[model samples]
Target: MGELFQEAILVSILAATVRIMTPLLFAAIGELVTQRAGIWNMGVEGTMLMGAFVAYIVVTAADSLVGAVLAALLAGALMGLLVAFMTVTLRVDHFVTGLGLNLLASGLTLFWFRSYIAGRPQPTFDGFENVALPGLSDIPYLGEILFTQRGLTYFAVLAVPLVWYFLYRTKYGLEVRCLGENPKALDVKGVNVAARQYCAVVFGSVMTGLGGGFLMLGFSDRFLAEVTAGRGWLAIVAIIAGNWMPKGVLLAVLVFAFLEALATHVQVIGVAVPHQVFLALPYLASILLMMGFKVRAGQPAALGVPYRRA
Candidate 1:
């Protein structure tokens, strides 16, 4: 028990928590924006998987991280466009549209993978390197835990404030918020509700894709099918558990990440528990968090509803 509380082990857990939280934070912020705009996109998991697959492909072929990330962003945006078309332009049920997209992404990526890399050894690429902040990385425990991390980790952390400012302080954000509560009012006032919704969904999808790309580039040396490993679902859960607030979402992500990190290191700490119990820690923690923080308020009223302008 005392060994588990050692300073070095504690710092390692903190650092691992940050790394695990990065992808979730990116996806949660994007989902938060989409929900605020009154669109319930359940295909987040599939979209993330697509982005991971695309990043792997580009990186394997071109060996360019920039190209890989851009490709992922484009793929995610295209998926968002598809969702917007089905739910906004065609008035299809949002859930059906999202489910269909997930299925399509899953099938398409699998088919491409089997066709291209069939019987071939899995391709590997150099992932993003950690960048140490000048002067900050030198600080005792806090600095090493927070300052020395991958570039995407920093971006994910910075995005929290940027998203909050955009959602609260900007006119576009005001409209987005209104769209979720009463899009009819915006339509009556001559604001293009569908257009705004489209923009919001696409923006969210782009961010989700960036998250997937980071997972592939920063977390793993080689790509595997289903590389996202349910992080997308966890992202959605974080948004709900956080009551749709950015700071709350950040905290939720941290909680989940901490559990995941602890799970990873449980065996190393010489705990007497079974390894399987340690492995399930993250999911168990997620369920507990969701159960504890019931979403009784703050959800968009029109979420998951297809809007039909009269």
Candidate 2:
């Protein structure tokens, strides 16, 4: 009985870790692609928050999961478009543009949320449920840990390899990488540098939006202000700590997710330590991870530098 109970706890923790990883993975990997194309978007937190907010509204008002997802995507795309315009066209500092977006999103979402629920009970919806894959979900321990998960969780896991292939194997991928290294070279070859950066930024924001939607629909029944709770910041940290590689990002995300999962479970298991300590573990780990990782070899040389034609 004792052995079985311990095993169950282990499985539960691992499963939670995988689930928690979904949102962070989406945001981190997406940002990895954006950074590789020379744009350092700092508005991930706002983009994600907007996605989550739009999703919650659509889901509750229309009661349509599909609509909610689409709304989140649209919201993200809009944010991306603004980022591209400011950074690529207006030549605003990338950091400034991103931070401005974050502030706008924060203030805008809070006001909208307040108006949304005014004189009404907070809206709620049935979030995603686990989908247990047949044959795979039946396997002993691994099945419980890996096979039974929200559908988006599976997709998030697949995105890592898919993104890796896109970055390392495709022709366009090489051009995108070149944008980070030498946009002038691409321009000499007649490739449009600003256009490529626009596409990259939009793509990253779209994915981050999807991640935000997943974070909301998969984990919570209703929306709250700042619902992302700094996961966006953590995603940025993961990109830096992972050396901007997909595999490294995956490992980094797993560690952070595991810490978060441990925190969630610690409350259930009734550990004597303050719950706040467990809650702080992932952020604390982020600081340690950043301090420990010194490698910047994979970083794009021209990243965050506004492109100009000679």
Q: Judging by TM-score against the true structure, name the best candidate.
A: 2
lDDT (C-alpha, whole model) for all candidates = 0.88, 0.93
- Cα lDDT tens digits for candidate 1, 1-310: 6777889999999998998889889899998999999998888988898888899999998999999999989988998898888888998888888789888988898899878788988788998888989999999997879998998899999999999999999998899999998999999999999899999999989889888888898888877777787888889889888988899999999988898888888877778878788778777878998899875498889887888866
Which candidate leads the pack in lDDT? 2
The root-mean-square deviation over C-alpha atoms between each candidate and the true structure, in angstroms, is 1.4, 1.7
What does candidate 2's lDDT look like per residue over 1-310, in tens digits? 2332597898999999999999999899998899999999999999999999999999999999999989989999999999999999998999999999999999999999999999989989998889999999999999999999999899999999999999999999999899998999999999989999999999999989998999999999999999999998899999999998999999999999999998888888887789999999999999999889877888899999999997
TM-scores for all predictions: 0.96, 0.97
The CA lDDT at 79 in model 1 is 86
Off by over 4 Å in 1: 268-270
lDDT of 1 at 127: 83
lDDT of 1 at 297: 92
Query: Ten residues in a row with the worst lDDT in model 1?
Result: 221-230
